[model samples]
Target: MHLFAMLRLILLGTTLLFSLITLGLAANLVDKLGDQWSFPGFAVAVSVLTILAVVPMIVIDLLRRGALMSWVVVELPIMGILWVLWLSSAALSTSVGLFLGDCSSFSFDSALESLCRQYSALQAFSWLNWLLVKTYVIVTLALAILALMKGHKRVWFSPVSDLSFSPTHTHSGEPKIPPPATAPGGYNPDPRMAHNHSASPSSGYPPNQPPTLYSPPSGQYPPQQQPYQSPYPNQGPAQYGSPVQTYQSPPPHAAQV
Candidate 1:
């Protein structure tokens, strides 16, 4: 995921850089070529080029965070604008060429007169320009609304703006877990079970048996008097307080005690 995120960031930055370069080239071209319909047509082309370039970045962002609907809300109108601009530019260029052909050799005054005379031709051009500008304005405003609606204030009109609509974390505001508390040696004996090492005399095993591990001595002994020895001689002598003890008693006085 980290590598994928880094890839996304690289792609997004590259897209922004490319968009700026294209825009700079567009500005220089517009200045050099003058502000004819062709210049605006180039502007439309640059916008479309920018939009196409960033689409992959937007798709990756959407897939990473599941923001598909938000993506649509922002991108659909921009696509519509591009379509209108390209379509209108082509149609209007053809219409103008046809309209001027009839008065091709006319003077400026005569051309103006002919232009005014052909109201249908004038109206066609007007409608095409209107649609082009109208689409631009509408798409721009829709993008603005989408950005605000998704709480992305910094990326309203930018070329790579769609990458900003990240999804809210589904696990946000959940409680965190602390590490498990442990005692020395990574062992945490339960307080209730910490002091239960004493042996019960009612069981066949004598109190002298080891607390954990035990084995009989190698010496031969009667089956009824199996050998037993104190496991913790350092603690104290073992007690033989009940009848369960079957071994030969140590000393009469010691056994009585």
Candidate 2:
């Protein structure tokens, strides 16, 4: 069990014990007094109500079941009601003259003194029960507020004992899965290429026996080449094999003579 849960159980059990004590004393006082006063009867009623309500809640909490009554939304209101009841019972008991007066000073009879002591005990337990209820309510409310502020909106619907107030803890949303490895320009590399890149040189094809290149199937051949054409269409082709003619300078001198 959680530390918080265990503490809650202990506090609840103590409150339950106090409620039982208050119930017994109030019932006995009511029987002896016979409805002469209304406070004792009120105390008896509140104690019975507390016992009936708290017993089932304690059982559910002990079982750690996710029942409707165990939810914070439901439990808070129930606890608030009980808090008010205990406070009223305590206040009414305090108002009685017997609770305030000294039992030994006033009562000469031993039985009457004992009865006065019971009234004092009853009043004390009623206040103690109210204080216990108040403490639980305040602590629960503070935890709920802290959880809400930390983005745990669903905490209101969840069991108080099961919740953690740590800022690092998350109650909702799925765990994020990281995206696949990507290259520059948003390209995802092929798994095979990545494997090859990471593989040891000795594990792959030998350095001399490189991987084979793709070839055409069976009898297919490349097409024949076409003849080349000159860019200047009007120019004649040069005669490279013919000899060059010599210049006739003597014919010009013969003409002058």
Candidate 3:
């Protein structure tokens, strides 16, 4: 019991730690957004929208709520935001539209001097940090998301009091009860199916279908008997070339009699 409690605590701590880190990244991204805004083209538009969507979700993840924290509640949105940042960064390369004067021709000292002109302190600065910094930031953001996903998940309840728990299913090492039969949840019924489906497999009729009378295929009926004929004397031998004859006639049940 203590071992389980320890594992859960570790998971909770990791989840919260990732949340804090992602929060920091979100703020940094928001600040960097301003630097990218002046760039022309559609990537800027996408970058703006992505940053806008990401910041609030990160804030929500950082903010405390009454409900218990879970993967979907706290980490799912942050992971999605990280993916968006990955994609948007590709679309908006750091080299474009920052108005950073070309430092290619400047010597190391000359470049540092230009920084004063741009930032009211030096002559210039090198943008070599642009690629490496963004790459590092993205990698950390991805790791935080990964750690959040790897953390243990707890039920939305107070941990103080508990009875025995019998789980029907487990996902990612976490015990879970199967969803309610008819609820709109992970185990929900298909929307295209009928509502009155039978709960028992031994039902008389197929589930969701009304009872139907079975019909045999054409030509599958039993063989029918023909009427019996009586062999009697030919009254007149109408053709005159045939003999008049009389014979014993069998009864209806006489075939075996």
Q: Which candidate gets the maximum lDDT versus the true structure? A: 2
Which order, best to worst by TM-score? Answer: 2, 1, 3
Q: What lDDT tens digits, residue by residue, belong to model 2 across residues 73-162?
A: 888888889999999988988887764557877576887887788788888999999999999888888888777766676778888676
Give the per-residue lDDT of model 1 (tens digit) for 1-47.
44323544554455445444434544543454466536334544644
As a whole number from 0 to 100, the lDDT of residue 140 in candidate 2 is: 84
In TM-score terms, candidate 1 sits at 0.26
Where's the lowest-lDDT run of ten residues in candidate 2?
167-176
Model 1, position 209, has a per-residue lDDT of 57
Score each candidate by Cα lDDT.
0.46, 0.78, 0.39
User: Cα deviation of 71 in candidate 3 (Å)?
Assistant: 5.4
TM-scores vs. true structure, each candidate: 0.26, 0.65, 0.24
Q: lDDT of candidate 1?
A: 0.46
Residue 137 accuracy (lDDT) in model 2: 88
Poorest 10 consecutive residues by lDDT, candidate 1: 167-176
What is the Cα-based TM-score of model 2? 0.65
Worst 10 residues of 3 by lDDT: 120-129
* Candidate 3 displacement at residue 250 in angstroms: 99
Compute the lDDT for candidate 2. 0.78
